[model samples]
Target: MNNQRRTVLKSGSGAALLGMLAAAGIITPGMALADWNKAAFDAKSMADTLKALGAGSPADSKDVQVTGPDIAENGAVVPVGVASSLPNISMVAILIEKNPNALAATFVLPEGTEANVQTRVKMGQTSNIYALVKSDGKFFMATKEIKVTLGGCGG
Candidate 1:
């Protein structure tokens, strides 16, 4: 009787452990989709890209600030910064006008956290860089033109 009780308890504990692991995403049998759309990135213009990415029409928001050099010596890596003063910032996406794929990067911001992000992106040539901000269920944006002296995409 004692042996049977111990075996049952051990089996129950093992099942519980497996449940916890699955909840924590330690195991997944199939591929995972993370909201990536190739068609959207292939957009020809910034406006088209924004629409395809579901960003809607982003308004010019003074509360959002973008920092970057006015000119870049190398187009391969252009540093960009975005900081939002507004509340409930949900996301930040970087876009380059001249790149084959305009959407460079996208970041999801958690609640009650500071909305600031920085990253380097490749540029095909001298083009406009835009920072798209999502706050309060709306999209806001800021843009700057970065002149690239040396072609990074291909000379």
Candidate 2:
């Protein structure tokens, strides 16, 4: 029993030391973090956001879908989702037409990842939510209107 206890402590201490080294930056992480797109998120208009994201004049597509309640009971926590059935989707972004910043969220999909995402966003009022999808170096988009009973972005 004493020998087993010593073995457990030895392995646990080694793991803890390695974790400390990583946390202290003595060891580098294997994965690199993606840089934030400040310009895209700070854009006040849909067009500007698209421009910042390098997607120009996206065509309307039935293959892209934006799902949300027609009327959001609470503006602060409106549920939304974006999905694309199109092949080779590389990115998906959500835009709120009425928000102070039109660009709400953007997601970059890795290879083999499904082109679908769900999230909650705040709405200032009744507005059209746009889902922009990028596939095979081309951009496509769809929009859905959501009415907010109470203002979330400050009435």
Candidate 3:
């Protein structure tokens, strides 16, 4: 099998094993999941989400970059990218202002690693996307508005 297929199989099997364990109570549901910012992910508003993320007052930064299509053809799956030229970026998060959950994703960067990440997220409607970056123990962010269309057919 190709490397990509092998990796997929390995991950799939791991998830299956974890599911079995959780079902059998050998592992609790929480034990089967990775550590994450639950509060941030569950926050409904931008202010609350940033508070949960420990970025209560993030400064706007030109070094931070948020890249995505101005119009996402499909609201079910919108591609987003976040990067930063600032130094010591220890964390990166993508936030959607109008989504049920403001914070969509977060990545913790190891020391010396570049602050660049990309992911796809669901958008219920048009919203502002923010790329929040933690650099040198300070929080910074950039934002862009993305219009979400219903299948690009104007439903």
| lDDT leader | 2
How does residue 97 of candidate 3 score in lDDT?
Answer: 93
Residue ranges of candidate 3 with Cα displaced over 4 Å: 1-34, 151-155
TM-score result, candidate 2: 0.77
Writing each residue's lDDT as its tens digit, candidate 3 over 29-136 gives 443233455667889999999999999989999999999999997987889999999988899999999887889888999987778888988888888999999998
List the lowest-lDDT window of 10 residues for candidate 2: 26-35
Per-prediction TM-score, please? 0.75, 0.77, 0.75
CA RMSD per model (angstroms)? 9.2, 9.1, 7.9
Query: Which numbered prediction scores highest in TM-score against the true structure?
Result: 2
lDDT of candidate 3 at residue 121, scale 0 to 100: 83
Candidate 1 stretches with Cα past 4 Å from truth are 1-34
**Local distance difference test values of all predictions, in order:** 0.81, 0.87, 0.83
